[model samples]
Target: MTNTNIQILQFGTGNFLRAFFGSMVQDLNENGNNLNICIIQSTSSNSLQQLAAQDYKYNLLVAGFKDGQKIEQIREITCVKDGIRLPDEEEKFLNFAASSQLKWIISNVTEAGMVMKEEGPFEKFAESFAGRLTQWLYKRFQTIPQSETVVLPCELLPDNGKLLRNFILAHSINWNLSSEFLLWIEEKVLFLNSLVDRIVPGFPSHLDLKLKESDPFLVQAEPYALWAIEGPESVCSHLPFLSSDSEVILAGDISGFALRKVRILNASHTAMTGHGLLLGIQTVGEWINSSDREKFLLDIIDNEIIPTINLDRDELKKYANDVLDRFRNPFVSHKLSDISLNSIAKLKSRLLPIFMDYKVLIGYYPPNLSLCLISMLLFYLRTPEKIRDEQEIKLWFKNVSKSQSEIDVLKTALATWLDLEWNSSFENAFNKVRQ
Candidate 1:
C-alpha cells in the first residue's frame, strides 16, 4: 500500500514521468519505503481529469525482452495519491507543496516545458510550465525556507537541471521576487542534471476502446529503464530506493552516461526512423525485427557512432544490445509518424554531432551515416501522408520537384539542412545509393 504522505511533488502527468519516475515510486512504496506522490498536470491541455477518475491508480504494463527471453509485468501504481490540474487545483497544489515531507520535484513536461520567455503576473500564474514551476517554488520557499528540495528533470535536453534552474532564476528576476526567496532557491533547491531512458507509449487509443473498465489509465512501456542523476552526496543519502534497483545510476558526473545513451540509443532511432519510413516500416519494432534494417543500423552504430564516443566499448555494445531488445518488443507500437515530429531538429542534435565528429576524426564520412542522411532527404522529398517538420524545411523539400536529380537535390538540401560545407564524400556515397 502507498503512503498517504506526499513526499514527491511531480510537475507533469505525462507517460514518461508516470512510467519512469512514478513507477519507480511505486517500487519504493511496495518495498515499504513509504513515500507517495502528488502529481500536478503541467498544462491545462493534459487529460488529468481522466487520471483523477481512476482514484489516482493506474496500471503500468511492462513488456520487452531480457537475456533473449520475453517478459511481461503489470504494476498497479498507488504512489500517485493525487492527480492535480491547474486553476482548479491551485490551492491544493500550494497546500501539498508546502508539506515538509515533499523533498523531490520530478518533472517530464518535455524539453520545451523548460522555457519561459516571460512570467506574466503573480496573481495569474504564468501559463508556461516554467512559470508554473517558479510559482510553486516560491510558494514552497515561503512555507519552508531551509528545506532542501531536489528537482529531477527527466526531459531529454542536455544540462536539463541547470538550464531549468536558470529559467527559474530568470523568472524570479522578471517577477521582481524578494531576495530572501531568491536566496532560498539558489541555496536550498537542488537541480540535478539527469538522463532518463524508457519507452512509455501511453494509453494506445486502439487498445483503449477494448480495455476492461477496471483499468482506464493503462500505460505501456519497455522493461528497460534508467534514471541517471548527477548531484551531491546528499542526493544518494536521501533516495534510498536507488540501491534496491539496478535501474538508477547516481553519480557526480553523469555526462558520459548521457552521451552514450542519448547518442547510441536515441540517435539510432533518429537516423534509422526516416529511412524506415522510406522502407515502408511503420514502427521501431518493424525496423529492428527486419534482419536487413537491423544489420544496417548495427553497422552504422559500430562503424560510425561508437568510434567517436568516449565511453567504454563493451558498455556501449551492451547498451546498444539492450536498445535493440527494447525496439524489438512487439507490444509497443511506436509509430514513425510520432517519431517524425521535430525530426529535423532531432537529427541535428543526435546524428549531426556524430557526422561532424567522424568526419573530423577519420578524415572521411561513414557511408552508412551518409546513406541515412540521404534517406532523410528522400523522406522529405516524398512527403508521406504524415506531415512533420518545420514549414521552412517542408517548403525547401517542396521546391525540389521529382524532375530534379535526387542525388543533386540530396547534396544541395543536406548541406543546407546540416549548415555544413557540401562534402563530396556524402554526395558520392548518396549517389551510389541512388543508383
Candidate 2:
C-alpha cells in the first residue's frame, strides 16, 4: 500500500497494539472507514519482516469467559499496510510522517519509553523514541503545516499524551527548531491522554496443535477491551473508531477510568506478583485458582483500594469483580514475572497513592497494603538477582545485609525507599504475616 493510504502511524510493533488497536482499525476498515496503518518499530526486531512475510496479515485470537460462557473468536487483521523500523528505514519513516492522510499517531512504547533524552542533529535519526518522533513531527510540520494531527499515547503512565507533547516540545527547543514549527505544533497538533485496558499474553503456544495455520505474528488476548481517550467529542469525527460499537470511550476526563483500572486491575497484579511467585504460581490464572491467594487479592482491593478511591463504591466493586474475572481467564497465561518488570515503579504508581490515602483516612496504613509492600520487599530481599528493576532499586536490596533481621530490614526499606511511616498496627500485621 502507498504511504498516502496509511492514515495511522503507530509507534511500537508489539503484540498488545496488534491485538487491540490493529483489531479496532481492522473493524473500522470493514465498516467503511477505509483507514490503514503503518507500524513503526523502534527496537531491533524481526517483527516487520514477520508481518511482511504474512502480507501484513495476522490472526488475533480473542479467547476468554464472557457472560458466563466461553467465547473464542478469531479475526485476520489487514489494517496494517506496511511497517518501517526506525534509524534503518529513516527516510521511509519520515515520509509516512509527512503523509497527507496521516491523522493519528498512536504509541505504546512502555512506561520507560516515555523518557526524554539529550540528543542532537535533527537531520539524523535520534536514539530515543521521543527524539525520533520530534524529527518525524518536524518533517510533518515542514511538509504539511496546515494539516492537523492527533497523538494518542497508549502508555500506562498517567497523562501520557501531555508528557509526550512536553517531551517533543523539549526536544524541539533543545534542537533549536524554528518558532513557526513550534507554533504549528501547539496550534494544530492534539496530544491526547488515553488509557487502554486489555490483557494480551501474546502467542497462544498452548493451542499450537489446534491452530489452523502457522502464523508467527499471531497474538492472543482476553475478550475484554477498553480504550478511554481524554478528548473533545469532535475527536470521534477524526477517529471514527470511537463511534463504532467497539469499547473505545471518548471522555472529557479519563482520570476516573484510569484510576479505577490502575487501582483495581494493575494494583492487584503488582500486589500479587511477588507473593504469587513466592508460592510457585506461574500465571494469573494459577493465582486466581488458589483460594487463599484469591482471598488475599480481594482483601487488598475491596478493603484497601476501593475505600481510597472517591468514585462510587458499587462501581468500584463491580470493576474489581470484573478484573478478577479477567484474571480467571484460563486461556491467557499472564506471567507474574512479566508483571514484575520495574516492580518498584509499578508499586509507586499503582499502590503508593492508595497506601498514603488509606493512612490519612484511617489514621494508619492499611494492613493488607502494608503486607503487600512487605511481601514485595521480602521478595526483593530473597531474589535480588531475579528481580528486574532499575539498578538503584536492585542495589538498595543488594545492600541490605543478611545479618539484619527481616523486620528491621523491611522497616528501614519502607522508611527510606517508599517514605512510608512506621506504625504499631503495621508492625503487628507484619509480625503476624511472618508467623
Candidate 3:
C-alpha cells in the first residue's frame, strides 16, 4: 500500500484508470512523490469491494509499438490506499476531501456522469457522481483553507471540467449555499479541462486461457497515449506529480488539442467501429491487418476530417499516421462494441464536426460520415433489443419511439446539433438506408 499522506482521489477503478491513471500515479509515487490514492465508486453499491480488499492491486498489460518494435509488458500497480462507496462511505470521502494532504482529484465517470439537474447544489446526502463531487467540494470549502483543489477530469467530453464546475455552481445555487462558498469555488478550486487518449482494451479475462497458452503473460493496449490539460500557471507549476515527460501538456488553451483529438483520433475510431465490424474486423489489429480498412481510415482522415479542422494539416497528418500505426498493434484486442459504448455522445462531439464541416465547405455530405450516422441510429434503435433487462430495454425503446423514424430523426437531429442545413441531397443520402 502507498503510505503517503498526500493523496489522490480517483473516481473510477475500471481498466482504463487501472492501466493509464493508476500506472501513472504509481510511477509518480515511485519517483519520490509518495502520493497515495483513494478510489471511490460514485454509486451506493460498492462493486469494487473485492478489488479494494486486495489493496487495489491489479495487473495491467501494455502491448503494441514502442521504439519501433512490438512490445508487451505486464505490470502490477499498488498505489491505491483504499476504496469506498461514495454514498455509503460519505463521511470517509468528506473527511478525505477536507484533508489538508489531499492535493489532486480525478474522474473518468463516462459522459452520463457529467449531467447535473436543476436541483442546483448537492443535497445533504446524494448518490450520483456529480452530486457526490459537489458535496465533496462543499466539504472542502467548509473545512480546508490556505489552498484549493486541482481537478483533472478524464471523461471523454468537450470542456468537461467547465461543465462539471458549472454543475457544482448550479447545485450551490439550488442548495442555497452562501456567496462566500461560491466565491471560494470560483477562486480556489481549479478545474482543468483535459483530453485523454488511450485505447486500453481492458482486462481480457475471456481470452485468459488462450493468452496463457500462447504467451503465458499478455496485456492489451494500443501503441498510443496522450493527455493534454488546459489550466492556470499555478496548476502547471505544481504538476510534477503527474509525469516527468512532455506527453502530458499543460497548455494555455486546449481548444487546439480538442480539435486535433476530435478530428483525427475520435473521428477515425467511430468511423472504424461500424465499417470495421461490417468487414469482420474484431480487433484493432485485424482492422490494421487489412489494407482496405487502413486506406479507408487514412482517406477519411485526410480528405473528410482534416480539411474541417483548424490546425496545421501537415502536423496533424504526421500525428494521424502515427495514430494509424498504433491501430495496427498486434497484441491489443480493442473491440468495436466497447468503443461504440456512447455512440450518441461520440457522434455529437467527435464525428458531427466533420460531418457538418464537410456539408458546409463542400456543399455536399460525405457518404462515409453519413454511414456513421446511420450506424449510430441503427445502434440506438436495435442494439437495445439484445439488452437483458426489460426495464432498460423498455427505456431505450421509449427513447427510440420518442425519436422520429430512425433516418428522419437522425438526419434532423444531426443537422440541428451540428448547426447545418437539412437539404434535399442530405435527406436523400440519409434516407438510402432504413433502420
Candidate 4:
C-alpha cells in the first residue's frame, strides 16, 4: 500500500514551528488531507530526542475567542511520522530526505540561521545553516531527479525564501557542484516566501501544574493563526492540504502581506512596548485589551500605517481588525520585556519606514508614531536596555551639545539610525508639541 501523505521535511523542533506549523499540519491531516511530516533540527543539539520519547505525540492547547465567545481545545498531534536530530541521526535524516514522496522543504531556523560561513571549498554538512541545507538538497538532487522540490522558509527575515535559495546556490558555486545540478536547482526548485504568525508560549510554566500534567510535550497557543505563502499555483495544487486550511493563505504577492505585517503588527510592538511598559502593562494582550491603549494603537495603524501600504484599503483595515483581535487574545501573554529586547533595530526595520514615508508623502511628522519613538528612546535611556543598544546612540542621546535642540537632535539621531537624511521639518511638530 502506498503511503499517500505528502512528505515534508521540517527544520527546527522549537516551540514556534511545533505550535504554529506543526499544529496546523496536524489539523490539516485530521480534517481531510494526508500530510505526514519528518522533523529535523539542523544542529549538533539532540533536541528532537525528547520529542521522540513522547512517541512524537504532543498536546496542543489552542485558546481564544470565536464568534465573540471564549473557546479552547486540546488536540493530540500524531501527524509527525518521524523526528531526526542532525549529526546524531545524520544517516537517518538523509534516508528520510531520499524518500520518493518528499515534497516541500519547510524551515524555521530563524533569521540568523540561514547564514553562509565559508570554511572549506565544501565539506559535507558544512557548519553554517545554509551550507548544511545545500548538502542535503544536493543529496536530494542526486537521489530524486524526477521530483520537484519547493522550499518554504518560515523565517521572519525579509525575502526569506528568495535569500535562502540564493544562499544555497551560492554555496553550490563555492563547493564547485556540477553546473547541471546548479541549473537543476535553479530551474526545478521552488522557493516560496512565507509569513507565519501565532503565539506559542511553549511548556506553559505559568499555567497550573494540573493543566501542564495533561501531556509531557504540552504546547499552548492562541486560536488565531496565519500562514501566508506566496508560491506558484502548481505548488499550491500539489499540496491539497492548503485547500482545506483557511488560515494558510496562498497569496498572489506576499510582499504586500509581509509589508502589512512587518509595518503594522511588528511595528506596533516596537512602537508600543515601551509605552505599554510605562502604562504598567505586562503582556501584549493586556495592553491591546485596554480600551485606551487599543484606540491609540488603532489610530496610529489606521491613520498613519494603512494609508501608505499599496494593498486594498478595505482588505488592509480587515487585516488590521484581525491583528487587533489576535492582540486581544487572552491566551497569549506576550511579554513586553521580551519584545523590548534589541528594540532599536526592531524599530528601524518596523516603524521607521512608516515614519520616513509619512515625512516624504504627508509632509508632516506623525504625532502618534513620533511619540512612540520618543517614548522608546526615553524607555531605553532610563532602563538596563540602554547598555544593550549601541554605545554611540546612547551617548548621542546623552551628550547632544544643545539642550534646547533636543527634539531636533532626537529627529536627526532617528534619521541617522535609519540611514535617512534628517530634515528640520520632521522634528518641528515635536518641538511645537514640547512648547
Candidate 5:
C-alpha cells in the first residue's frame, strides 16, 4: 500500500538481483525516474519476510578491483517498495501484476528455475517458477491487455528469454487458456534475452562485525557488472536505467557476449569448483590465491575454452585475465558450495558446450577438461550429502556405491549420465590427477 508506483515486478529476492538489478533501479530513481520495484519471492524462502521487516530496503556493498584500482562502496537500496511471497501471497502478487503502472518483469531464478515441472491446478499456485509466471502473465493479460510489459530474464542460460516465453505459452495451452491470450502475449509482450554478470556473495558474515549497522539482508558483490540485453532500440525506452551510468547493453544480438561469459566466467567456475572443493579450498579467493590451482584453471580457459569460442582471441584473453582479478577480490567470499548448486545443469550449459567444441575445434578431446569431469565425479562421490541439485540428480549420485573403484565410477558417470565417451587418454589423465 505504499504510494510509490510499482513499475517493475521482480521474480526473485536473491543477493544477485538485489545488488545488480535492484541497485541499477535505485540509480535510475535517484536520477529522476520514479519507478519502484515489487519483489515476488519465487521460492518458499524467508527473504520476503526479512525484506518486509526492513521496509524493503537493504544495504549493498560493492567492493572489488575496477580499472586496476581497488574500490569499495556501500549504499542503501530503497527502490523496492513492497515484497510478496508466491502461493502464500498469490492474491497480492496477482494484484500487483494487474497494476497498469508495471512495465518490466525481471528474474534471476538461476539455471534450474527455467525448467518446466509438473504443476497442479491453476487455482492452487503452480510449483514451477515458469508455471507461476504463466499464471501471473494471464492475470496481467486479463486486467491490462493494451499495456505492454518487457520481460528480461537474467538467467545464465543462452536465449533465456525465448525459453521462458515458450514455457509460459506451453503452460497457457496446458491450462486451456484462450487463443487470444497467447496472441496477446505474442503481440504485446517483449521477452528480451539477457546475460547478467556479477558475483554477489550473499550476507557477508565475515564483515558483520565491521558493519556500522545491523542488517539481516546485507548483500556484498564485486564492482564489475554487465547486463547485456538483446532487443530493439525501442526497448530502451521502457528501461530508464539505461540512461544512467550502468553497463546495460541493448544489442541486436547478445549471443556473442553470452557465449563469452558462459564459456569463460561461468565455465571456469564450474570447472574449478569440483577440484577446488576437493583440495579443501573454501572461497574463490583461496582457490585463485593458490598458484597450482590458479594455473590449472587458467590452462583450461586459455588452452581449451578460448580456442573453441569464435570471438577475437585477444579480447577473450583480456576477459579471462579480468575474471582472475575478480576472483582475487579480497572483499568477496564467494563459496564454491554456492556455485556448486545444480552443478549438473551448470556443467551442461556452461562446460559441456565447450567440451564438445574443444573436440571439434582442437581436433581432439581436451585433457584438462577431461580432468574437470573426473574431478566433478570424484567430488560427487565423496560428498553426496553436501550436493544440492534436482532430486533425481542427487539420487543418482547417492545411488553410486562407494565400493566401486574411481575408474569404474568415472566411466559409468561419463558414459551414462553425460553421454561422453571415455578413452585411454582420459583414463591416464584421471589416474595421474587422482594420484
Candidate 6:
C-alpha cells in the first residue's frame, strides 16, 4: 500500500487519538480510501527529536470484552506521514496550514487547551491552543482564498468547535485581517461540535506479555464506540467516510446527546472515582469489583442524576447501563486519576447539569450532588499547593466566609456554586462535609 495525499492532519498523537481517530484512518485506508495522516506533536520541545527520528511509527494494542467473550486486536499504525514538532520549526507548521489536501482537523488537547488567550495570532511562543489555531486559519485563508476547513475538535468541552471558531474570529479582529476574510471565516468554514465516546486507556502492561508471546504486537479496544456530530444536515452529506447506522449521529442539536454523555457516562465516572479512591481502588475494574462502588454510582445516576435529564428516560438508562458494563471490562485498565484531570472543569460539565436539572425538577436541593460540590471546593483549595496559583485559590474562596464564627463557609461555597440559596445550615451540611 502507498500513502496518498494528506487528507487528515491530526494534531494530538496521544493514546486517545491513536485508538480513536488513528484507528479510523487506518481502517479506512485498509478499505482503499488512500487517506494519509500527518501528526503534529503539540509539545515536543524535549522529545520532538526522538519522535521525529522514529518517523512517526508505533504499535497499538487494544483489548476489551464483547458479548461475554475476550477480544484483542493488534496492529501497527503507519499512517503518520510526517511529524512536525511545533517548538523546533514554526515555518513548517505554518506551511501545513495552507495545504489544499488537508480536509479534516481533529484534536484532543484536553479542556483547558480550548481557552482563548489574549495574544495576537502570530505570537512566537504558542501560548494557547486557540491562538495557534487562529494563526493557522489566517494562513489557510491567505493561501487558499475561497476554501473552508472542516474542523472537528474531540475535546471534552461542550460546543468546543463553536468556542474555537469564536476565538479564531476574535483573533482576526486582533490581527486586523480584512472584513472580506472575516466574512469568509463566517460563511465558509464548518465548525461542528462533537461528542466522542471511547474507552482508550493506552497500552496495557500485563497484556503486553501475552501479546508478545502470540504475535509480538497488538492494538485493541472495547467493542463500543460512538461519534455524535452536531451540525447542519449537509455535514454528513459531504463526508461519505463514516459508518452507516448507530455509530455516527447527525442531529438537529447535539446538546441532548452531550447531556446524556456527561450526566450518565462522565458523571458516573467521577462518582465512582471519588468512592474508589477512598476505597484504595486504582483501576475501573477494581472499582467495579467493589460491591458498593458500582451500585452507588448507578444509584446516583438513576435516583439522582438521570431523572433530572431531559432525554427519554428508558433510552437513557439503557445506554447508561451499556456504558457501565464497558467500564467494568476486566481487560481494559481505565485508571481513576486519568478521569480526574482538571476535575473542576470536568465536574462543571459532567455533574452540574444534573444538579441544575434536579433543582428545576424536584424544586429542592440535591444533597449528594451538593456533597460533590463541596468535594470540588476542597479539591480546588488543595490544588494551589501544587499548582502555585494563589489567585485562582482566592477566586474560588471569594464566596466563603473567612471568620470561624461563620463556620459554615464550605456550605455557603457549595450553595453559591449550585446557584441555590438552599439553607446552607441544613443538618446534612455536616454529613456532606464528612463525605
TM-score of each: 0.82, 0.88, 0.85, 0.78, 0.94, 0.84
Q: Output the better candidate (4/5) by TM-score.
A: 5
Per-residue lDDT tens digits for candidate 6, residues 1-435, read 113367776777666776777777777677777777777777644444554565665566666766777776667777777766665656777787677777778888776567777873355645577777777777788888676678889887789888888888887788777898788888778888888888877657546355444432234467567788887777775554475322767777888888788778878787666545544467888878877756666777788887887779999989888888898887788877666666555666677667667868987556666555555455544333322122444576553445643336645654655444545423464465565
Q: All candidates' lDDT scores? A: 0.77, 0.84, 0.70, 0.73, 0.84, 0.68
4 or 6, greater by lDDT: 4
Could you give candidate 5's per-residue lDDT for residues 22-65 as a string of tens digits? 88988888888788888888665687897898899989888888
Off by over 4 Å in 1: 1-5, 43-46, 67-69, 86-97, 116-124, 203-214, 243-246, 330-332, 364-367, 373-435
lDDT of 2 by residue, 276-310 (tens): 77666778888889788788888888889899899
Listed per model in order, the count of residue pairs whose N, CA or C atoms clash below 3 Å is 0, 0, 3, 0, 0, 11
Q: Which stretches of candidate 5 lie over 4 Å from their true place?
A: 1-4
lDDT of candidate 4 over 125-179, digit per residue (tens)? 5666778778877887888777778788887767888999899888888888999
lDDT of 1 by residue, 253-282 (tens): 899888987788888887878778877787
Regions of model 3 farther than 4 Å from truth: 1-6, 43-47, 120-124, 205-219, 277-281, 386-394, 398-435
Error of 4 at 332 (Å): 2.9
Models sorted by TM-score, best on top: 5, 2, 3, 6, 1, 4
In model 6, which regions exceed 4 Å deviation? 1-5, 44-50, 67-69, 120-126, 208-220, 243-246, 376-435
RMSD each, Å: 4.3, 3.1, 4.1, 5.3, 2.1, 4.5
Give Cα distance to truth, residue 292, candidate 5, Å. Answer: 2.2
Clashes of 3: 3
TM-score of 3: 0.85
Q: Residue 215 in model 5: shift from native, Å?
A: 1.1
Report clash pairs, candidate 1. none
Q: What clash pairs does model 2 have?
A: none
- Candidate 5, which ten residues in sequence have the lowest lDDT sum? 205-214
Off by over 4 Å in 2: 120-124, 388-435
Which should have the higher lDDT, number 1 or number 6? 1
Local accuracy of candidate 3 as per-residue lDDT tens digits, 1-435 = 222374789888666776667777777767777777788786544457867665666666776777787766666677777886756777777777668878889898776566775443345676466677778888888777566788889987889889888888877777787899889988888888998888788756544444444332233555466788887676756576447332677777888888887778877887777555544456666776777767777778888888898788889888898878777665667877677665656666777767778879998877766665665555555556432222543365446554466656555545543455566655654565442
